[model samples]
Target: MSAVESSARRLPLVLRNPSFGRVWAGQLLTQAASRMFQVGAVWWLVGFAGGSHRGLDSGLFLMVSTLPAVGLAPVVARVVARHAHRTVLAGAAAAAGAVAAAAALLARAEALPMAAIYAVGLALAACQALFDPCLTTSVPELVEDADIESATGFELSTQSVAGLGGGLLGPLAVDAGGLPGVVAACAVAYLLAALLVRSARFPHATARTGGGSPSDTAPASRTLRQVLAGLPFIRRVLVCFAAANVFTTAVYVVMPLYTRGVLHSTGSTVASLEAALGVGTLVGSFTGARVPGRPVAVGSVCLIVMAAALGLPGLAAGHAVALGALCVVGWCVGVIGVRFVALFQRLVPADDKPQFFAVMQALLGATFPVASLVFGALGDHLSARTLCLVQGVGLVPVALALRWAGGRTDAEELPGSATQSPARAREAS
Candidate 1:
C-alpha cells in the first residue's frame, strides 16, 4: 500500500475511510503551511522594522492583519456559496501564494512598508476567511451525517499536527533567512498547499431527491433585511465566541511576555511550548471527535481546564516548573480550539453558514486588538504572573456562558438554511 493509505489504515475506522482520509490530509497540510507563514511573516516584520524605535508591536500588526478579513468575511462567504467550494478555495490558495511571493520579494528589497505588509496581510486574510466554511460545508458531501463528528475530529487532529510542524519550522526559517527567508518559506508552503488541495477529488454538489439542482433548491436568496434577521442566532454564538476569543487572545498576547520576562525562557523554549500546545490540541481533537452529545459542554470543560492550567505556574517552584504547567495549558487550549469551530457548525444554518461564520471571525478578529490594548495596560500595572492569573479568572464567566448556551438549543436546529441561492432569487418565493 502507498504510505498515505498505510498511514490511514493505522488510524481509527473513521479516519481510515477513503473519503475522510483525503479531506483530513488536505487540512493537515494546509494548516501546517498556514502557521509556517504566520511565523515567517512575524520574523519578516522584525527584520523590516529593525530598530528600537520601530512603531508597531507584533500584536498590533496581527490585529491589523486580521481586521480586514473580519470586515470582508461576508463578501468572501457569499463567493463560496455562489461557486463550487473547491474552485473558490483553489483560487484563494493561488491568490495566497501570489501574495506570499510578492511579500517575499518586497521584504528582500526592503520595500516592505507597514502599509504594504498590511495590504498583503488583508489579502491573505480574505483568502482564509472563506476557508473555514468552505471546508466545513464540504464535509457533508464527503461523509454521512453519522460520520461527520468523526470527520470533524480528524480535521481538528490534522490541524494540531500542522500547527506543531508550522510552529517548530517557522522560526527556523526566520533564523536562517531573516524576513526574506521566512517569506520564501511561507510562499513555497502556500504553493504546495494550493496544489495539493486543488488536486483532491471531492463529490459533486447535487440536489436531494425530488429537489431541483442544489443551488435551485437552496432557500430563497436573503435580502439585506433577511440577512440581518439572522442576527439573533449570530448574536448568541458570537457572544460566547467573543468571550472565548478574549480568553485566548489574552493568552496569545501574554504568553510570550511571560516566557521572556518571568520564566526567563529562550525563544526555542517558547516555540517548543507552542508546539506542545499543538500536540495537546491534536490529542484533544481526537477525544472531542469521539465524545457524544453536547459538543458545547465538552468545550466548556476545555475552557475551564485551560483557565485553571494557566494558574499552575503560581504553584511552580521555578521557571522549569512553570514551563511544564504551560505545556498542560496548551493541551487544553488545543481541545477548546477544535470544539470552538465544531460547536459553530452544529449551531448555524447551512444557508447562513458563511455569514454567521464571518460574524464569528469578525468578533474573533476584533478581540485581538482589544486584548492588546487591555493586556498591554495590564502588563504595565501588574506582574506577568498576576496578568495570567487575571486572565484565568476572567474565563470563569465564559465557561459559565458556554454551559448556559449548551442547554438552550434543540437537537435539530441545523446550522445552515434550506436555501442559499442569490438572496434576490431566494426572496422571490
Candidate 2:
C-alpha cells in the first residue's frame, strides 16, 4: 500500500512541475500541428492536385519543402549558438506560420503547382531547422539535471500522442473543411505553438548555451572545426538512421499498392492500417520511456521489429493478419523514435546539439527523397511482394552496418579526456 500510495503521489509531482509541464505542452502542440499539417497536405495533393495519396510520394513534396532548412542548417546552427534561444525560436515559429499560410492559400486557389508546393515545404523546413535546436537545448534550462531524462520521456510521449491524435483528426477535418481548411487548421496550430513558446516558463536566454546569434557577440564560438569534430559520432548514428530509413521507405512505397493490388482491400482499410501505426507509435513512446538498457540496443531491436512488420504484408496469409503485422511495426517505430532522440542527446554537447541535429535532418532531407525516387522507379519493375522480400532481407545487412558503426571506436576520442556516460561508453568500446 505504501509503494502504491507513494507511486501515486510521485506521478502528479512529475506532471505538476511548471517547467516540465510547459515544455511538454509546447512539444505536444508542435507535434500535433506537424502531423495534422502533414496528413492534410497529402490528402490535398491527392484529392485536389491529382497526385498519389501515398506517403512516399507525398513525403517527397514534404522533403523538398524541407531542403532549404537542411541546406542552411549548419549556418543556422552556428547562429543559434550565438543568439538568444527565445528570439530565434519565436522568429522560427512566425516564419513557419507564414509557410503554412502560403500552403493554405495555394490549396484554396486549387491551382497549386508541384513547384509551388515544394517551395512552401522548403520554407517550413528552414524555420524548423532553426526552431528544433533551440527547443532540444531548452530542456536543460527548464529542469534541474535530475529531471532531464524524465523530461525527455515526457517530451517523447507528448510528441507521439500529438502525432497519433492529430493524424486521426486530420482526415476528419479534411472532410469538413477541404484542403483550405486543413492548412488553416495547421497554421492555427503553429501560431498557437508560437504563442505558447513566448509565454512558457523557461530560463532566461542569457542562461542558455547553444543557438548563438548571427552578430557574434557571445563567448561560445562554435567554428567550422569545432562543428566538424562531431562528425565521427554523427557518422556512426547516421549509418543506422539512414539504413533504417531506406528500408522503411522502400516498404512504404508498396503498402497501398499492395493493399489495393494484391489484397483487394478497401481504401478505408488501408487508411485504418496507416492510422493503426500512428496509434502504435503513441503506445511505443510511453513504453520506450521505461526501457532499462542501452538506447542503441533498444533502438536496434525496435528497428528490426519494424522491418519485420513491414514485411509481414507479404507473408501474412490474409488481410487481417497483414493489418496486425502493420500495427506491430508501427508500435516499434514509435519506440525507435524515443531512443533516437535520447541517442542524439548523448552524442552531442549542449551547445552543438542543434548543429549536429541539423546534420541529421539534412541527411534525412537528402537521403529519403532519393530513396523515395528510387523506390518509385523500382516499383515499375518489381512486384510488391518481391520488393518486400528484398527490403526485409536487406534489413539484415543494414542492421549489421548500423551496429558496426555504433560499435566502432575512433582512434581519437572526445577532447578533455571525457569519461563517457554509460550510454556512450557502451557503443564506443
Candidate 3:
C-alpha cells in the first residue's frame, strides 16, 4: 500500500509539524474573531435600523458584504496566483485588521455611519475570500502528502470551534464594552493571525512562488481555460458542491423560521440548535479522518445522511427532534467538507490550485446570499416545515449526482480506465 493509504486510518498527525501547527493556530484565531465580528456587526445593524424592517436591513447588509466574492472572483484569483502564499495570508490578515481597527475607531467616536459599516464589512469579506484559498493551497506544501486529509479535517474543525466561540463570546463582548470593544478584539485577533503566519516557515519553494516557476505560470485567461479543460473531475465535483450548498443555505434560513413558526419557540431555541450543530461538526471532523475509506465514497454517504437530517424536522415538530436533526446535519457537513477538500487537493494540479479553489470559494460565497434571498422570500408564502421538506427533497438528487460523479471520476483515474493512459491515470489518482 502507498503511505497515504496505510496512514489513512490513523489519527491526523499534521499538528506535530510546526509549520502546519502555526497556520492552523492562525486559522483558529482569525475565524473565531471573524465570527465575533459578524455577530457584533449584525447586532449593531439591527439597532441602527431601529424599525420593524430591521431584518430586511440586516439581510441587505450581509448580502452586500458577500458581493465581493461574486464580483471579484477573477481579480482575487489573479492576485492569489501572482503572490506568494505567505504573502497573501499575512497581507489579507493585516488588511482585515486595519479595516477592523478603523471601524473600532469610528464606533468609539460615535461617528460610524451605515455606509462606513457596509464598507468595512465588504473589505473584511474580501480579505477572507483571498485568505481562505491561499491557506488551502498552502497545506500541501507544509506537510507530507499522507497527512493532507488529516490537515483538512483539522482545518474544517477550526470553523466549527470558531463559530461556537464567536456565538458564545460575541454577545458578552458587546454587553460589556459594546461594538467598539468587539471590533477592537477582532483587530487584535487578525493582527495576531498575521504575526503567526509571518513567523511560520514553509519548506517548499513552490509556496514562495505560488505553486510554479515564473515560466510555468500562464496568463489569467489561459489559466482559466486550462483549469476548465484539464480538470473534469473538479468541474463535476464543483457542480455537486454548488447544488448541496443550496440546501445548506436553506437550513440556515429555515432554522430561525422553524423555531418561531413551528416550535413556537424563541431565539434561544435557535441558539441551542446551533450549539448542537457545532458540537456534532466538531466530533465529525476528527472522526472522519480515522474512518478508513476513499474520501469521495465516504463523502457521498455523508451527503445522504445530511439529506435525511434536513427532512427530519419537517416530519417531527418537536424542538428536541429539530436539534437532533441539525446535529446530524452538522456532522455530515463536517465529514463532507474534509473529504471533498482532500479530494480536491489530491486531484488539482499545483499550478491550478489557486484558481480552482478561488472559483470554489466564490461559488460557495455566492450561493449563500442568492439562496438566502430566495428562501427568505419563500418563507413569506410557505410554511417553514414545507420549505424544509422542499430543501431536503431537493438535496436527494444532488447527493446521487455526487455519488455518480465521484464513482465515474475514480474509475477514470484508475489504471486502464477508458479515458486515460495507465501512467497518467496513476498520476491523476
Candidate 3 versus truth, CA RMSD in Å, comes to 6.4
Question: Per-residue error at 259 for model 3, in Å?
Answer: 5.0
Query: Against the unseen true structure, what C-alpha lDDT does each candidate score?
Result: 0.62, 0.64, 0.73
Query: Which scores higher on lDDT, 2 or 3?
Result: 3
Error of 2 at 75 (Å): 3.0
Q: How many collisions per candidate?
A: 17, 11, 0
* Order of candidate numbers by lDDT, starting with the best: 3, 2, 1
Best by lDDT: 3
How good is model 3 by TM-score? 0.71
Worst 10 residues of 1 by lDDT: 420-429
Answer with 2 or 3, whichever has the higher TM-score.
2
Q: After superposition, how far is residue 246 of candidate 3 from its true place, in Å?
A: 1.3
TM-score ranking from best to worst? 2, 3, 1
Candidate 3 shows a clash count of 0
Off by over 4 Å in 1: 1-26, 43-56, 139-156, 201-241, 263-266, 288-305, 312-319, 334-366, 376-383, 397-429
* Tens digit per residue, CA lDDT, model 1, 263-300: 66544655666676666666665566665444566667
Candidate 3: tens digits of C-alpha lDDT, residues 1-429 = 888756654534544577888888888888888777765565554433355544444455566666876887667768877778888899999999999998899889986777787788888888887887678778877777767888887886677788877755664566567778888999999999999999988887364445556667665434655776756766787888888887776665676567666887544565576677788787777677776566667767788888888888888888888888888888887777776676677666676776677667777778877666677567667787988888888888887887787667655434235755554443332
- Give the CA lDDT, 0 to 100, for residue 95 in model 1: 75
- How accurate locally is residue 378 in candidate 1, as Cα lDDT from 0 to 100? 62
Looking at model 3, residue 112 earns an lDDT score of 74
